[model samples]
Target: RKDALFEPPVSTFQPTMRLANVSGINIIPGEDTFCMDCRILPCYTLDEVLSAVEQCCAQIEEEYGVEVCYEIPQKSESPATPKDSPVVKKLSSAIYRAHGIQARTIGIGGGTVGAELRREGIDCAVWSTLDECAHMPDEYCIIENIVKDAETLVEFFSE
Candidate 1:
């Protein structure tokens, strides 16, 4: 069980680009459980996010035979500039169109590395293309997503 948790079989995961940075948090070391987090800032758009969500839902339905519901962050729960941010606005619009769900971005009143980076004079943004599946029993990354994210980061760093 411990080995299985720590060493997942290498997937046939072929990505179009290399990762910019990858990091993880080991919350329960003895339990052999960990959280996978990565910094792939600056590589997402609202349209792409929506399309991916739609595709994810379809895949889940077809493969797992389950209905997937998507939830967008509440306006009061997101960052203050989230709505003004192009990425956030696009995400809200795409979710509304694809899922008939009214999504909004707001401020999150919490501490994160993002805040620390800002304090240290590093500009950063946080976004995700996948459903929040960081710390599950069988956590895994979608290979196509890694490729898209790598491309996104390349573009992000170029600006």
Candidate 2:
């Protein structure tokens, strides 16, 4: 949480496992693997989160008596884009022009491809319109959202 703004930080850990292969219907599997998606806070470093995950895995291995091998397929650093930066200015202005809504700069818990670009010293911003149906059976993108996003991009490019 930010003391000055009284805003809470968003972070999450999601665990997933898949039964990739099986020897036989009745045979017990030799091992199983799972994945952990850690969306850490901007204040924490990647190494810190990784270390915490490793510790958690170790504890689970000891408590459950099952071996746990973890790997980070990808790690991205969350860097803030200055509100006054040209890219942000253009995006904010475009959003207002396209939707007549004032866009506010904010931090997100999920990692975006822009994070990679930001880590490379490039200014990047991630934006989208949604109704919170992502990854669901009824997930979909509205046509109006597509049109609005396109208009916003056009406005950004124009100026």
Candidate 3:
């Protein structure tokens, strides 16, 4: 997955630690854990992605002499919304009407409610343009964009 950099985050790892020995403030933790939010892309199967992750964990264990274990707490995959989907066309049209420009589809990752509906064969769209602060602490979007988004949605639903 050398091209992963060009894609949205198909996988994100966040490592955590549990102290087995609280000997001192400077002591190395004896146990560590990591959870991965792994999303699926058409380029690779879920099995292929997990296998690659397992291999990486194995390498870390060998290099650091630390035991490693992992589990898939949950498994869910949603089909991607095609650019030509009716829902996308309608939304794009709404955006065009609102701003006199086209709206293009791009890859985005994270837990979106649209993902659940898309899995159930719904093609509805949710979109916005914002800075990289999404999903971070105190994330925000422009107040003006909110008003514009409402206007766009009104156009979309009125169609």
Top of the candidates by lDDT? 2
| Runs of candidate 1 exceeding 4 Å displacement | 1-112, 121-123
Give, for candidate 3, the lowest lDDT window spanning 10 residues.
1-10
RMSD for each of the candidates = 20.0, 3.7, 3.7
Residue-level lDDT of model 2, residues 1-159, one tens digit each, is 342211245566777656566777887778876676766666678888778778998999999998888667877776677768889888999999988989978766555788888888898887888888976897899999888788889988998
* lDDT values for all models: 0.45, 0.77, 0.73
TM-score of 3: 0.72
lDDT by residue (1-159, candidate 3, tens digit) is 433432553544444444355567898876755555555664566677789878998999899998888778777667677778999899999999988878867655556888799889897678775677976799989988888888898889989
Clashing pairs in 2: none
Clashes of each: 5, 0, 0
**Candidate 1 residue lDDT tens string, 50-154:** 686589779978997666665443211111233456655555555555445565343333345555665565444554456567756878888877765565555
**Best of the two (1, 3) by TM-score:** 3
- Sorted on TM-score, best first, the list reads 2, 3, 1
Rank by lDDT (best first) = 2, 3, 1
State residue 17's C-alpha deviation in candidate 3, in Å: 8.5
- Consecutive 10-residue window with the lowest summed lDDT within model 2: 1-10
Indicate the residue-level lDDT of 98 in model 1.
43
Q: Give the C-alpha miss distance for residue 67 in model 3, angstroms.
A: 2.4
Tell me the lDDT of model 3 at 145. Answer: 80
